[model samples]
Target: MTLPVEAGLHRSCCLIDTASLSHNISVLKKGLAPGAEIAAVVKSNAYGHGVRIAWRAFVEGGATWLCVDSLHEAQELRDDGYTGNLFVMGHIPPAHAKTAVSLDVRCMVYDRRQIDALGEAANAASRPLRLVMKLETGTQRQGLTIEAALNLAHYIARFPYLVLEGTATHFANIEDTTDHSFAYEQLRIFNEYNDILTANGFRPTLRTIANSAAGILWPHTHCELVRAGITCYGMWPSTECYVSARLLGKDVDLRPALTWKTLIAQIKTVPAGSLIGYGCTYETTHESRIAVLPVGYYDGYDRAMSNLAYVLIRGKRAPVRGRICMNMCMVDVTDIPDAEPGDDVVLLGRQGGESLSAEQLATWAGTINYELTTQIQTNIPRIAV
Candidate 1:
């Protein structure tokens, strides 16, 4: 289904392939045990593929649960008529506890101060509030110590309105390097904490600690549930993740679901030695044909991509010229003589025989694919193709 492009949109939009999403889901499922639940993390607008669009795709692709970064994101999915389990995997302000409870969204909790408010909200709503306890294994981001988690679990058990439904942790170095020793150590620590919880008679319905990288590379880490984030969208967590999967002989296929495209807003010719864009970072070495694209840093095309990236125009690569501005950038389309204003430009997908992968764009921009996709402005229309 093609989404309508609204008037005044920059003509730069994303196309999400639901078939590819389904394919990725199937790949993830094959690596899991039977009846293992899969939670598709749809935070940051489903990595800026548009949550509303990607949310439906994930559900249709067989995600048993949807994970979001905030209560508002979960609410957005609920408002859109998604009836599956919604896990708010990030912190929600205590003030929004009542609303979160009403929405029946499961929240990840690490703070003790939030308990009373959440319990009160759940009681007021006459429903149990589900929560996941994040254990501080090694990432040290948003997790509690084992003792603290035990205390919180006991505290949560005391409140009839609160249900400690899960326990989770994050791996710090699973995706950055081929060596997974650190990740294994983190897993060992997590298992110790899980043992404590189990011995204390706090059996969470879900015991999960694997993100996309770990989920894909480490089979033993797949517990009762696996929170598939980047991989679900058909992007690897990192090259290391792909390497690890191959080394482990895991035949996993991930199809990229997002295709970023824009139109050539204008075409112009510049004489040799003419400078292009801000600060005159690049000069035309020869008489050059330039295609102006209405996409720039403001639209999530990183400014660092200036003079370093290429977009597909007329089935050929058009190297970016000069600096990427807030609202536009220029691409040398001299090689593609047929390229003209209103011609479709491929920024992050295949065009004819050429393709631009997110990894390629990320390398040029000095960032990662996760940031590239998540940084895309939510205002950009994402059509499910």
Candidate 2:
């Protein structure tokens, strides 16, 4: 019997280790303050790790709440038999009000129009809807100012179907800088807004301000809920976050669980001075052996990674050559002359004693680790191992 890989059933695939995902969640949860609920942000297909496969593992690893970015994701979760607390942190369009209400998801709201639509839908459906107010804590995105927040809180009180259950703010500077002074100020402003709300009798049960960076760097920011996103997948938010965490003596262990792989489609020898790929961007410096791999920009391998990234072949680094094409790319395998067609090529993951990290690939793509993993094409098979 031929194995699926050897049979060429897939051009490229991602191996998602559920055990490592669970381990990452458990490790993140360990750093949170007591009584703070851990919410796994499984939006964007669990950072492109396959939502269907990640949610179960996260739940198994002690995540009490699952957060998604849209009503569609919430519905998918509910349809998949995920009967737990679900938070919708993205926009709930006016058209999706009824569906959002039917899904029974807690929404993060900052606009009045969203409230009107959801309030009407919830009333029509005769189902109470919970909402978390997003306060503008200097992010200037998806949040309301103090005055706007107060007005919305009072407006929400008018609708019997709507109950404001929480207050949340995102730190814009937490992960990008080791100097957390700006983040601390954002936290102070968030708390001030919460105080104003409490003084006006809008008591929020859930006060959430801690994201992955804050959750790891400061236990004091972990109020009632901690939203763990990238870190939940065993990838750090940024180098600054990792440095800050280490400086603070809170380097919780994180293990990446994604291993992207493809197979060598062909191998050929080219004499020195030969032009390679689109735009003749590369020329062979010597008599070279080139291996063509069935993965490229369309496979979430960034076009910008051309001539800059390397792939793992038989425990050796095969430098990418020339411009990456829409559906394929070439790597110089002269050093590994024995590399043959059908050999497994690791795009991102461990191979032998060496490992290619998401961070490194992101660097080649001129992006971050989150975008690197999240941009991976969903069409690619994600095997949950």
Candidate 3:
């Protein structure tokens, strides 16, 4: 939504608190044993917090490595001057092996074709491409079976140009339930796979099987490196993750580092019995003052939050009225006397003592905080606080 210059300045922006980011890193580090490293997962533009800014915060906070979803993301980090250990945790197409090897980015390998391509690329470039083999431990996603993993390790040993530097796995339900029986089972299977690999003379230097939830709740799973994703961004993976942490006596003090703000595009008075916004879903029973916001579903402000959510203006809660439009929505600011056009509007952050958290918005939108924060349109300017 377009706005006047004054309103545009505040219409939409995300503020990243570097101090809070560092605090989270410290919290995660406290749980790790000596020699265990933290690989900050900075994929999806640092979960929509701006990769360039957040990755720097992570590096300055002493992150040992950076994990991203794609080769492009790794290139972005390199282009932005991040010279730390960068690994692509997600799939890298066989075609991008040359670029990946040239850029010195580690990649996860699951298929023989990928390994062959990467080995060829590394041979051609005269540079060893580090690889992490993902073990299939019930996730059923991108991973190799125990037998396949062992075979791949044997196959990789023949390639002098390809180095199997690590072995990893993804937990399917570690964050969903407090009863981590399934996760423990997955870990057991992962260990069995590792044992087989080691038995076959394929001992990887680094072994990681913990995501944010496992890293926080199960310290034993933090083998050589822990990949901290949502938690590093000051967000809990799930309610169960928080509970599991407390139950395990690993109470971490995580402060959210992002604050999304907008501005009131227009302020108008609506008479009683007037319909508001799309679908005529909301009817004003009394004379009300409404503040228009230059943000909606298009900006990752879920359309489902149209009638269920509220924004903060002038330190007061302003309930959203009616259906949310593509680029705008209206909040009932009748109780907020000082709210007017160009007034600061908090979409997902604190305003004075009132705050709108990602978790709260996730509830209102019938989703999770990860989806809420990660879905924020990347085009919106992110400023460091």
lDDT of 1 by residue, 231-262 (tens): 99899999888988899888788899888988
lDDT of 3 by residue, 1-385 (tens): 2333432454598888988888898889888867789999999989989998899888878888999999999999999998879889898999998999978988899888998899999999899889999999998999999888888888988888999998999999999999999999999998988888888888878999999998888888999999999999999999988988888887789989998988888999999998999899999999999888989899999999989999988888999999999999999999888777878888998989999889999999999998999999998888888
- In candidate 1 the C-alpha lDDT for residue 87 amounts to 85
Provide the lowest-lDDT 10-residue window in model 1.
1-10
The 0-to-1 C-alpha lDDT of every candidate, in the order given, reads: 0.88, 0.91, 0.89
Residue pairs in collision within model 2: none
Whole-model lDDT for model 2 versus the true structure?
0.91
lDDT of 2 by residue, 1-385 (tens): 1114522466888889999999998998888898899999999999989899999999999999999999889988998999999999988887788998888899999888988998999999999999999999999888999899999999998888999999998999899988989999999999999999999999899999998999899999999999999988999999999999889888689989999988899999999999999999999989999999888898899999999999999999999999999999999999997899989889999989889999999999999999999999988888888
Report the Cα lDDT for candidate 3: 0.89
User: Evaluated with TM-score, which candidate comes out highest?
Assistant: 2
Best by lDDT: 2
Better of 2 and 3 by TM-score: 2
